[model samples]
Target: MTAPITMFGPDFPFAYDDFLSHRAGLGAVPAAAHGTEIAIIGAGIAGIVAGHELMKLGLKPVLFESDRIGGRLRSEPFKDGAGAYAELGAMRFPPSSRALFHYFDKVGIETIGFPNPLAPDTPSTVIELGGVKHYARTKDDLPKRFAEVERAWAEALEEGAHYGELTAAIRARDVATIKRLWHHLVESLDEESFSGFIANSKAFRELGFRAREMFGQVGFGTGGWDTDFPNSILEILRVVATGADDEHRLVVGGVEQLPRRLWALVPEVMAHWPSGTSLASLHNHVPKPGVAKIAPGTTKKFAITDRYGTTTEYDAVIVTCQVWLLSARIDCSESLFHHDLWMAMERTHYMQSSKTFVMVDRPFWRDVDPATGEHALSMTLSDRLTRGTYLLDNGEDKPGVICLSYTWSDDALKWLALPLDDRVRLMLHSLRQIYPTLDIAQHIIGAPITVSWESDPNFMGAFKANLPGHYRYQRRLFSHFVQDDLPEPHRGIFLAGDDISWTAGWAEGAVTTALNAVAGIIRHLGGTAHPENPDPIDRWSDLAPVRLVE
Candidate 1:
């Protein structure tokens, strides 16, 4: 028998019965005539943004989602009297995502800088390496971090040059250099594990210890290993550096409020508004029109199911699910989109991460850092005992609530594979690293709640990673709808999500991709659309390498 669903805290905010009833109500809406302007699959931030943009252009968009509207941006209420909510999936936005910030502003959402609890001016971060605690104040204080990172970049540059030299011999366009370097990066990453890649490099070893320090200081997770390009570490570094200045923040009420506000902006044009819909399978063809077969016995008029157990039909479908899930449902024969792209996407790996909100009768950490008082956000690289724990202060209610987020790499996943009690013990043990004095047994009022994105069938991972050999394919996939082989209004389906652009794995990326997609769609609709300038990092030149004689 399947494992029973464990309820550690109060029930989900929305009543299960209410959610089901809402789903059922959707089926009652009469089906409109075939061939709408657009059909958006996945009502996550990407789909929501796209739908809103389409409405502004006077076009109607039918939004579809298999589960919740927020996608990974989900938050749930804490059971204890914290009077606060904890993020089950994604949290925080990078400051660089100006487009996303504008969207939130337009919707009247406000964000506050994360309040640091440990040290207001400069937070104290520690990394637990092989069960030992190493502390650092500023990012630069981390030993050997810069040297190791520089060495890795040097190696990557050398590899790129070698590859570029060969490609340039055949053709001289900047495209050749970009493609060659891109190919080299992806191949190198795919050939070995990220750890293995560093170990094998003599230059990397010289810098590896320092590299770890740098990553630890900056709170870089193993998730960093998954990228769209393997060969260009420099590119990834640039994106990371650019995003570092951005502070993590939340909308006054909740991040979900952002999507709800967007929907309110254009309710009439959105499909299944204030409701829900499910997509069965999508049909993609070049010359002829594509169809999305809906399932029968659907809960609402928007509900769809078909004979092969598929349902829902649309003139155009924009899929925003993880690349892997999209690959499974795609009809390869009819899709002009390359199959190699799908294969490369499957090879990318995602780390299993978990976030838990502990509701204590008091803001325990506040006492630990008395100077800052109770309302401060402190981000830590390591807990005395736990790996990957970051502390966030939820500025709501006294005996304030702090959300402790624990992220695990492959090693932690192995520990998670253990029995439930063992996992709980492990979590508590890790908590001791941060608070050695507090008796977790006594202070804990109730069972802790955990959300594992990796374990979710629908998600399977937190977000898309740009692993080695994957960049080219990722770029192509992001631009698929805009390619010439597709029908008029060729950019009919724009891919939006964290994985689509440089801001991949971020909310900003989702918004940026949505903006780009919307612009394309508007242009196709005969509306004037102007392209924005390339990202600042896109203008950077490859750093010249230093040569050493052995």
Candidate 2:
């Protein structure tokens, strides 16, 4: 049987999964470097992971956060909850996210199949388009046109990019083959947008414009990715090629528990620190205030000033916050990064997203309609303002949660000005048009919750989605961890976050990149990886990402 596709990159195809599972435990710093202070900004997954690993390596990591921990993995529980909650940021996680799953497994976080549209776990799915609704227990129940669109997408992938071979290479961990195929694609499609790739594909061209429009509206694996049409085809290809869209699962209780637990976890074995040491224990159970400024100190160190007028200096700094924050929220020194790196940070594009959720009395949507004998409501995908609505059932006799609406990009922008009450009403109105007989408002209990990440002062947007012609910028950021070529001033401050990774929006990227930063910090402090379990930087030259000439 073929091995399952992991997020072993086509860009930098390193076996991070293998590295973490090894007994070496992420390498070690010298005795002199032990307890060396390294400042990490943002208490999100990236920051937390970096701190955890660095602490294991005998380094003292000081973490600063502007808001709550977990970053984009924000899960807000309902007041009447039996573990029912709204996943405001990242809800569904793909099985291919092996690195992220490693942390989940370490923390004993359980997961269940997410009820994505057409997923087997979902009881039924409803697709609404052009004011028409169709109910399906599976894809086979959809009209033949949907099948044709699915086939066209497959054909487009095979014809335009030889996607099958690329995926096979990735599964086999064939670095040379993966690089050869992906290099050709980067050269050909770096400047091509996703919509352009569709229009130009022979299969899509033959399928006609209407089919293309439907493909956008009812996209496979999640739903309605039309908002991403303007992004690089390379970005879309990376997702599908690595199987990042398949077999998604949600945390059983909430994803917030993963980071929170990690903060308090005392690893079975570690360097320098005592057996009872944990990140929580090190910081006295709370992280420092948000950072306000970072600049060069007089004695070859980085001075960090937090929001509360406290200043401290560290040997090295790793920033895991959104790249835009460096410019928008903090007063950062220009000399900390090279001009090219600065331009890449400036060019990074973040997609906006909004999610409105409400707690319902029970799983009332599962009731069979007496007149039609069909489910009253289903996991819905629509072209309406409420792009996608999900029914999250906790259990029998317990209050259920419903994600009334989840929208991205343009659709998300529409909800930016509306208040929570107005947002909930508008979503209910849109959903009602599909289920005319159902009064969704009647089942709603307690106050509704809503969020527009772009509106949040700390995070300007939901997540990064690179646009066409932005691959070079991505290359710059991803390759920055191996900083031997950079000048002295730019050497100490490293970048690690989803935005700095090849796959920006996914948590796997955050984990993998944090590992990269950990390795970088170890090396900077005169440490080396165990020979048997080398990190990404140890294999950098052989597996370095293909660079496009300017």
Candidate 3:
């Protein structure tokens, strides 16, 4: 059984154990609903998990992927193919993400603590501020100024956001306390930006904007909170208060395997469908064409036209693609969903991101500097062009990988037009300025690969970060997964992905939302959640996610 999660705001905070412990087959497919076919858009983690679980419940799910499987959970192999690869997206997993771990454990994925710059698993960290450099192997070694900034953030959360009370209420599953505490917060903080919260808070007010500047340059968890400073304060509180930023681990081989393994799994038995049916068998071991358009069909079903113009009919469709695709890429009908839902999807703010990586001969940064007696290079962070650098050591005699640079938002936008070689050169140039004596280029043994998510049509941008005053928009999107929230016309289609979830940018949100949609889909098809286990919304409706409209 999975652990129970405590959360704030509209992020569905439900017990994963309840989902597994239900007596009825998860979603409890009805005799009439047996062999119900579901059309799942996108082959990302969200789509794959939803499709996989639906299959287990005796439903047939056909997945369509415009690109390759795994979507954003992709791992790119280095050019020379020396078994070295770079995690182009989603490189770490937090222990608090029980829903994600459930899948990871089932797939037998091996994980170790990711070297998160100044994190414990990392041997050292080099932080650059202004023009000065400070090298430290632990948090204690950080300059006093950095310590002050960290404390201010902690204190700001406690006073300005009521972080402790909210988390404690959630941990205890005290619904009454949670609703009272969180509803007040949503009203007060919904229109507030992260920077605004930090500015007016007692600790931050005393420390001033300088502290805010440092936090933005090298954020504690995801790095460079500045890009997100304009985002809702509630979003940041949900991440830190829930312990989602602590105790992170990286999948050993690659995180993408979690989804890939699931695709290969063939259930022992299924309804109507033959035993040992897999996604490959269902699609004839071929790539299902991309969906070009979606509209309501003549009957109470959905009509999805593929890239090749072949239309398919299904009782329901779960769109796992990012919201922007509905407007920017696909030819979706306006009448298919509520006008408010269209606004939310169109207004979603996807943060820009870029990552440049290279394969190296070995972990040269592990070597001690002869003059300073400190390691040659630690996982580094700076306000320079190369905002942050990460190292991946693959043991002796194996090629090592270095994320030469990882940046976000405006910083990321700077390199959106640069070619891979230009990006690598500029990043190395910035690194040389920090480490004057080290000739880092000599260690390179393979071709470099880079990603500018905003430039890629498949992925308009990295992930979502809700902007100030966007609660109503998010509420519309998040609740869309629940069939009851929609009007008669929109009842047959559902939305599930990180963007629709409260905790965007995390895989946990993607998986959790997908599960929620699965239950909703079952309900829409006249099925039911197990009698032993009430629906998540039904069980916690009193403590339901904060309502922006009501």
lDDT of 3 by residue, 176-289 (tens): 776777778888999999989988889878887788899888777656678778889988877887777777898898898988988888865455567778776777765478
Model 2, position 210: C-alpha lDDT score: 92
| Residues 64-178, model 1: lDDT tens digits | 6666667787766666545556667766665545566667776788876553312333245554544564455544555674445645655743543353343332223243444
**For candidate 2, which ten residues in a row score worst on lDDT?**
77-86
What is each predicted model's overall lDDT from 0 to 1?
0.48, 0.92, 0.83
**Clashes in candidate 3: how many?**
1
Using TM-score as the measure, which candidate wins? Answer: 2
- For every model shown, the clashing-pair count is 36, 0, 1
lDDT of 2 by residue, 299-374 (tens): 7489999998899999899999999999999999999999999999999999999999999999998899888778
Candidate 3: lDDT of 349?
Answer: 94
Off by over 4 Å in 1: 1-37, 80-82, 115-235, 244-246, 266-312, 329-336, 344-348, 368-379, 383-385, 399-405, 415-422, 445-447, 487-491, 523-550
Where does the lowest 10-residue lDDT sum fall in candidate 1?
6-15
Name the regions of candidate 2 deviating beyond 4 angstroms.
none
